[model samples]
Target chain A: MTPALAIRNVSHSYGARKALDDVSFSVPPGSFTMLLGLNGAGKSTLFSLVTRLYAARHGEIEIFGHNIMREPGAALRRLGVVFQARTLDLELSVMQNLLYHAALHGVGPIEARRLGQAALARAGLAERAKDKARALSGGQMRRVEIARALLHEPRLLLLDEPTVGLDIKARADLLALVRELVQEKRLGVLWATHLIDEIADDDQVVILHQGRVLATDRAQAIVVAQGAANIGEAFTRVTGVAQEKLSA
Target chain B: MSEIAAPAGFTFRQYLICLSGVVWREGLRFLHQRERFISALVRPLVWLFIFAAGFRQVLGVSIIPPYETYVLYEVYIAPGLMAMIQLFNGMQSSLSMVYDREMGNMRMLLVSPFPRWFLLGSKLLAGVAVSILQVYAFLLIAYFWEIEPPTKWGYLTVLPALALSGLMLGALGMLLSSLIKQLENFAGVMNFVIFPMFFASSALYPLWRVKESSPWLYYVCEVNPFTHAVELIRFAFYEKVAWTSLAIVFAYTSAFLVAAILAYDPARGMLMRRGG
Candidate 1:
């Protein structure tokens, strides 16, 4: 089977400043990949390219063997994105948000409603489906966004700093939930963040710094290779940042 | 991955469904925002009642319409005000686009499998739908104010003209939204684009009246795209179609829409300028 996502030698720039530099990675089905980078490390820029929010002029990105630029309709039908920023229309009900996303993916109303309800149920937000998105708490709203992204039944999910504003418990719960979905639904995940704690030993980690890929391997492997005791030390060593500085 | 099968490329039926969904959401959002509906009416009504009342005597009217005799200032400016509503509404929709871009809602639309133009078209159509409702409401109020159209058929005749003019202005707004870097600059857009377009057009004053005062200003008013839009609606309200105005409106819509599409191209750095 083809990898869920494949980025080959992609580079992007804003004017003279390069944001992503010949970056390359792939995520297999049912696996979780953490895109680790510091602020201004070009993780978001890579995500934007992968999602076709901006075109990558120098390289290519593919979703499930379909080139994004060549076969966007086929490639995008299987990809979902949860951006870092809040995307919900505050005035719209949770259900309305999900249903609208479903429609955009060519899902009919009846099927959209059915899948929306199921996604909400999965997110533990079925009870709040009728409430306006503004009425929900931030954590609840993030869950709704996840539900909406999954409404189209995308095989690959790309999340950019998903737990930015959530509390510790909420953040942990969200990570756990996403992990469970990766296993249960066999969904490929590209979770981008600067947080070191979110990286698990078994998970694959891609370290990007200043638009360049430092390393791509299992978290445990990186730790062992760097002669570090834990991923936190391994992350700092790979990205050339101090531990205290990283957490700060 | 095995849980959900990926569908094929977008089908025509799916396109229709997306269009309907977008339009429906716009309608629902409009209904929820009662202030938008009220303001949409109140703006034009104020112009029709108070502004026109003051200008009626100052602007002499000749026998030029389905009516054999001279008409009131209210009658001449009605279509102009209607087009003005569309122009403002088009810009308002652009404001929403800017807000949505900042808020991340635009990403949902952009990442869809459908073509970018289709998604933008759906949005334009939705804005037009709302503008149409607002225009009809204003017309109803005008009717109650004893400012009726030339014929019962005139009401229906104005629909296509309103839709075209709305789309023209809406496309222009979309282009501006794409080019504008920051949301705060939207107010600048109002001052530079919206006010100039509204005032310089023959919306409040007839082109001939401007000609009598300053031929240069008359030439500017005659060439103004909004002026043609207003003229299209004005003629339609009198149960006639100004073929030249109709063609000009269509041309302006096409040009603005094409420019908007180009400006919205992610490769051009507009969408990428703001945080996505």
Candidate 2:
């Protein structure tokens, strides 16, 4: 079967500065794919292109065989996105934000409420549904965003550093929920992060640096090839940078 | 990997609902912040009740076409007050856009499934709706002050003109929001674009009145798109149709909207800057 998302030779730039250069990757259905990159490695830029927030200047983005630029609505409908930024309306309650998102996707009130509640429950935010988003903690706000993304039951979920600001416990909890989503719902995921701990051995990993893909394969295989016991060293070996330089 | 189903298409009805949803949210937000609504009304109301009062004696009334014989200074400036509300609201909306961008809500809007143009159009329509409400409220207050047109039909005729003029100004706000780089620079926009656009037009004085003061200023007022917007309202309040003003308002709306869309084009790298 065709992969859930196929990106081909996508290249983008910002006025003499290249954000994404000759970047290409694909995510199979029901697979958890982690996009590993440091800051400014074009991870968010790639997400923008995939979600059709920005058109790819010289490449094609195919969401389940639909070209995003040619058929944006259909392509976007198939993909649910959780941006790195907090998209919640601070004044509105959690339920209101979810309902607004659902309406944007053309879901009616009754079904929207049902789906929204289910998604909130899955994100462990059912009780806080009536609370204002601004009243919630940072981790709770992130969970609300995840719940909003799941309202449409998208076939593919694009998360850009979803756990960026979360505590260790929150991060682990979010990752567990994401793993469950991939297995139970058979949804494809593209999780972008710079942190190596977010990756699992069995998960698919794509290493990006300076807007180019360094390697793409099973996470454990890369670690083994690099003769490293964990993903951090493996990432360093693949990107050919010292640990301190990589940290910087 | 199993094959997943393709997603459904978006409908026109869905578009309308989404537009209404966005506009309603804006209205609700506006209502929640009572200060914004009060100020939206108070700014124009102040000029009408206070500034106009101070200038009434010094500013002599003229027999403009829309007016029958000598009109009161306050009555003559009503259309300008209406335009002023829209002008200020337009700038406020632009400021809100910048704030939204800084606060991350704009990113959420950009990622929506709908076309970007549709999203921006919805926002502009919402601003226009709010401005229309302000104009009506001002008109009601003006009636109690006995400064309104003589007929009720005159009031009815002003609605569409208010909408058209509101839309034109709102589009200008949208364009400025997209083009402005930082929130700090927005203050400069108010001083340079907002004040000049309003004062240079016929908002406070008739074009002929400007001519008596300075011929060049009068010429500038006659050519300004904002002057046409005010003229549209002035004529509509008198139960008369000004097609020339109507056409000019439409033209300004189209130009500003097209420029906003182009500036906001995702691939254009206009909004690619990272926000804190």
Candidate 3:
């Protein structure tokens, strides 16, 4: 079977600086893939390309077997994205934001309401639907973004640091919800984050460093192959940077 | 149950819907900030009522082609006030763009499935609608001041002209917003654009009057797109069509729109810096 998301030799650059250099990868249908990288590792750049925010300078990206560059509209319709920045409209209610997004995608009112409610329920934000998005707590606002992303029931989901500013429980809750989404909805997920704890043992992991993919494998296998006690150590070995150095 | 195949491609309807959605969002934001609407009307209102009153005695009314016989000083400056509303509205729309960037809503707009041009165009259209509203309000207030146009049909002609001029100025604002890196610099730039573009054009005074001051400045005013815009509105208010002014406004609108799109292209590095 063709992978739900396929990226082939994608490269991008900012003036005088290479943000993503000849990167290639694929995620099988219904699989959860974790993109691990440090700051400036080009993970966000890759996400931007996949979401069609920035067109790649070289190589092709396919969404559900559709070429992203040549057939962007079709490819984009098959995927959903949750950006690192807070995209919710602060002045509007949660339901209003979802309805606005639905309208943008051409979803009718009835279907939008149904799908929006289901998504909010899944994200544990159903009761907060009528509340202004600005009035919600930071974690609640993040959940609203996740719910909004799922409103279209996309086959592929791209998340860029979804749990960046969440508390420990909020982060765990969000990750757990994402895992459930992958299983229940049969979604191919590309979860980009810099934290090793966010990657599970069975999850497919790709280690990116300096705009290049250093390694791609099962999280457990990578940890075992590096003779490391944890996924963090394996990440350090592959990326050639120690945890202390990175923190500093 | 049989499976339903997804469609092969997107349509212009999708683009239209996205554009409408963005415009609706801008309208809602404007509604939320009621003070902005009041301020938008009040600025032009003050100039029309107070400034025009003070200058009416000193400023001589000349026999311009668009005007029949001698026109009142307030009537003479009404189109300028309309143009002023559009200029300020255009800048106000971009202020929201910068605000959205800082508040993070602009990122949402950029990540949509639709092309960036449609998104930016929708924003310009919304600004046009707001500018039209302010123009009509000014017209009603001018009526109270006994400077009403000869016929109500004159409004129909003025609408399209205001739209074209609003679009041109709004496109310029979008281009500036993309080029300006910091919000602090916006005030300085606005002072530069707003005053020069307004005073240099035929907004407050006639081009012939400008000629008496400096012939070179009159040449610059003649070439300024704002002059054509003001001329378009001035002629329309008299129930006359100024084809030359329309052509110039349309030409400038097309150029500004194209430049705005190129400035916003994701590959052009402007958006990349913001996205990055």
Candidate 4:
């Protein structure tokens, strides 16, 4: 089967400053792919390119087999994204936010309502549907966003630092939710983060450092190949960052 | 991956659904913010009640084509105030856009599977719809104050003109919003674009009066799109049409819309290093 996403020889620059250089990676179906990067490591830049928020001017990005620039409608239909920023309109009810997103994806009112209610219930937010979005906690808001992302039944989900501000318990629950999605729904996930604990030994890893991909393989494979104890050390060895700083 | 990729598009039914959804959301936002509705009406009503009252003695009116005979100063400035509501509304949409960009709501809309032009056009139409409601509300209030149009049909005739003029100003606002990335910088836009566009147009005074004051300002007013918008509304209110003004408003609306579409394009427009 074709990889759910492909970035071929992608390089992006901001005027004289380069943000991403020769970066390429792919996430296979039914796998948790960790995009490991430090702050300003061009992770978000790659996400922007993949989502067509910014055109991949120097290379090509394809979802499944659809080119984003040539067939954005088709590519976007199969892809769902949760950006790093908070997006819910605080003034709108939780259901309104979900319905608004559903409408943008061309979902009809009756069907959107059905899917929205079900999605919110799955997120443990069924009771908050009529409440203002501001009533939800940070973790609840993140869950709402995830529920919104899945409303279209996308084949691939791209999340950028989703657990950044969440508490440890909430973070674990969030990760488990996504992991369950991968296992049960056979969804392709590109989870971008700087956290080392989020990656499992069997999970696919893409180590991006300073705009370059240092390695692309299983977490255990990279750790064993580098003779490191864990993903943090492996990342340090490949990217030349200190082990102490890697986990921090 | 589906093998068939010819740049997919929504069916007409899907397109209509999306359109209604967008308009409905806009209406919801408008309804939730009763202050926005009040402010939209208050701005025009203030001028009609106070500024026009004061100017009634300063400016004498001759029989213009749109005016059957001698008309009150408040009657003469009614269309301008209606267009003012739209102009402010267009800017209001821009303000919302700036805020929405920061809040990430714009990202949700921009990531839609539909075309960008269609999305922006729907937003423009929504803003126009809001402006029309506000205009009619102001007209009802003004009607009680003896600011009625020439004919009862004038009320209906003015609807299309208000829509067209709203589109022109709304497109202008959309173009500005695309260019304005930061909210702090928006204050400068209000001062530089809004005040000048409103005051330099024939909204407050006649072109002959402007020419008498300064010939260059008269020329500026003649070319101002807002002037044409006001003229369009003025003529339509009297059951007549200003063909030249209509064409000019249409052309400017198209130009502004095209520019807005380009400005919002990430690859072609605003490719600032921080964002790209």
Candidate 5:
């Protein structure tokens, strides 16, 4: 079967500085892949390329066998993206925001309202659907975003540093929610974050460093392969930086 | 049961829905921002009441297309002032685009399965929608203040002209927003594009007056696309069609729309600044 997402030989540059250099990766169906990288590690660049925000001139990106460059409409139809930035219109209610996105995706009113309300309920935000997005807490806002991303029933979901600025409980809750989606819905997920604790031992982890892939494998395999006792030490060994310093 | 999945390709119904959504969002935003509505009115009102009243003696007016005989300076500049409101409102939308691009609202719009041109057109349509309302508001005020009543048909006739000029100015704003990397630079757009375009044209003065003052400035005003926009509105207000002005406004709107679409192209590096 074709992978849910496939990125091959993708490279991008900003003037003389290369943001993503010959980067390649893939996320298989029904699997959770953590794109591990520090800030400026080209994680967002990779997301931008996959999302077709920035065209990649050097290589191709395929979403469920649809090439983003050659067939962006088809490729994008199956893909949903949640950017690192807060995107909800502050004045609009949660349902309004989701329905607006649905409209953009060409979902008619009845179906959009049904799907939007359902997604909100799944995210435990059903009661807050009528409230303005600005009235929600940061964690609730992120949940709204997650609900919005899922409203279209996209096969592949790309979330960039989604848990940022959330409390530990909120972050953990979001991670668990996403993990459940993978198990229950068989949704493919590419979760990008610099947090080490977010990656589970069984999850597929792709370590990116300096616009290049440093490693791609199971968490324990990477730990053992890199001659380290755990993911933290292995990450330090792979990137030649102290993990303590990264968290600090 | 079959799933209600998004179609594999784009569809016309989808495009119309998105365009309507864009327009709807603009209307909601406009309603929320009462201050913006007030400011949009205040700028034109100040020019109409104070500046035009003060300049009435200095700027002598001959019978113009819109006017049957001698008219007050305020009467002469009302259409131009209406266009000015659209111009400023157009730039305001551009400012919002820059803010939206930075804040990630633009990404949501761009990621849709629609063509980039359609998306940009949706944005222009939204801007035009908001701006035309603002223009009519200004026109209502002009009529109440007794700036010089246009023909009864003038109120209705000027709409298409307003829409054309609004789209032209709004398209120019979208083009600038795509090129401009920051919102702070928008002030420079005001100083450069808005002020120059308004002043260099027949907005506040007749082209003949400009010709008398400086032949060079007259040529500049004659060539300025905004002059044609103003002329279009001015003529239409009197139930006459300025064919040259109409054609010029149409052509400029198309050109600006194309340029804006090109600027918004991913290859151009306008939308994808690494940190911007």
Candidate 6:
């Protein structure tokens, strides 16, 4: 089966500073792929290329076999992305924000209304739909974003460090919420985060560091290959190889 | 589901819905900020009440074609001030674009399955829609001051001119926003741009007056797109079409919009360089 998200030798830069370098990865359908990296490790840059926020200057990105640059309309129709920043119009009500997003995706008003309500209900934000986005807490706001992302019923969902500012419980809740959807809807998810604990044993993992992909394998397989006891040690071991490779 | 569309996956109905959604959101944003409307109205009214009265005798706008008899400075400058409201509204829309880019929702709009040109066009349409409302509100108040159009149907006739001028000015703002890298520096840039464009144009006074003072200044005003905007509205307010001014404004609108769209293209380097 075609991967939900695929990046092949993608490289991007700003001025002379390289953000992503010779990076490649693929996210299989109906699975949760944790894009593990440190801050400024190019995970956000990878996400940017995938979402076409920044064009893939040097490589190809395919969403369900559709090239992002050449066929963005088709590729993006099945893709949803939640950036790390706060995106809700603070003054607009929750429902209005979702409807605004739906329209951008060419979702009709009546259908947008229906899908918006259902998404909000699924997010457990049904009661807050009429309230302004500012009224919700940070965690609640994140949930609303997830709901908005899913409103178009995308087959692939990409979230960039979505739990950055959330509390421990809120982070776990957000993770569990997405994991449940993957199981039920068979949605492919590329969840980019810096936290290691978010990874599970069977989870597919791509360890990115310093604009380069250090390793790509299952979490447990990486641990075994690197001769590490846990994912935290595996991350450290793979990232260490970067310095030697760079100096060469 | 993954079959490559011919780049026109969306139908006309989807395009309409997208356009309506953008305009609706802009309308809601305007309503939520009632102070914005008040401020847009207040700027034009200030000149009409105080500045125009003071300059009534100092600047003589004799009977021009749009005017059959001697007119008050307030009557003469009303169209310019109408243009003024749009000028400010256009700049405000650009400011919001810069703000929205930082807010991060701009990405969501861009990542939509529609063509980039259409999305930018929708945004321009929304800004023009808001500016029209502000212009009408200003006109309603100016009516009390006896600055109504020269003909009975002047109000209805000026709609097209208002939209055209608004698009031109709003497109200019979007272009400026694309050049702007941050919010902190936008105000300084707007002042340098807005005041010069407004004062040097035919907004507050006619080009003939400037020609009498300085030939170079008259040439400056002649080249200023804002002059055509003012002339277009002034003639439309009198229920006549300023064909030359109409052509100039239309040309500027097309140029500014095309430049803004190109500046925003992902393949280009302007906005992405600014991290927008």
Q: Pick by DockQ: which candidate is best?
A: 1
Give the distance in Å from residue B1's predicted Cα in candidate 5 to where it truly belongs.
9.7
CAPRI verdict (incorrect, acceptable, medium, high) for model 1? medium
Candidate 4, residue A236: Cα displacement in angstroms equals 1.7
Candidate closer to the true structure by TM-score (higher is better), 3 or 4:
4
Model 6: per-residue Cα lDDT over B1-276, one tens digit each: 332333448889889999999999999999999999899989899999999999898988888878899988899899999999999999989998888888887777788888888998999999999999999999989888888976679998999999999999999999988888788867776679889999999888778878999999999898899999999999998899999999999999999999999987888848668555
Tens-place lDDT per residue, model 4, B1-276, is 333443367888888888888888899899999999999999999999999999899899888777778888998899899999999999999889878878877878888888888988988898889889999999999999988886699999999999999999999998988778788867888799889999999888889888998999999999999999999999999899999999999999999999998887767867344472
Clashing residue pairs found in predicted model 5 = none
Query: Which has the better DockQ: candidate 1, or candidate 5?
Result: 1
Give the alpha carbon lDDT tens digit for every residue of A1-248 in model 1. Answer: 79999999998877788898999999999999999888899988898888888877789899999898888888888899999999998899988888888889888889999998889899888899899999998888888888888888889999999988899988988899899999999999999988888989999999999999999999999999999999889878887788765453
Can you give the TM-score per candidate against the true fold? 0.97, 0.95, 0.94, 0.96, 0.97, 0.96
- Candidate 3 segments whose C-alpha is farther than 4 A from its true place: A244-248, B1-4, B11-16, B267-269, B273-276
True-contact fraction per candidate equals: 0.76, 0.46, 0.43, 0.68, 0.61, 0.69
Candidate 1: tens digits of C-alpha lDDT, residues B70-101: 88989888898899889888998898888888
User: Chain A TM-score of each model, in the order shown?
Assistant: 0.98, 0.96, 0.96, 0.98, 0.98, 0.95
> CA lDDT, every prediction?
0.87, 0.84, 0.82, 0.89, 0.88, 0.88
lDDT of 4 by residue, A1-248 (tens): 78889888999988888999999888888889999989999998898888877888988898887888888888888888898999998888999988888888888989999999998888888999999999998899999999999898888899999998999999998999899889988889999999999999889999999999999999999999999998998888898888666555
Give the per-residue Cα lDDT of candidate 6 at A152. Answer: 80
Candidate 6 - CAPRI tier? medium
Segments in model 6 whose C-alpha atoms lie over 4 Å from true places:
A241-248, B1-8
Give the per-residue lDDT of model 6 (tens digit) for A1-248.
Answer: 89999999998888789888999999998999999888888887788778877778798999988899898888988898888999999989999999999999888878998998899888888889999999999999999999999888889999999998889899899999999989988889999988888899989999998899999999999999999998888887888643223211
Clashing pairs in 4: none
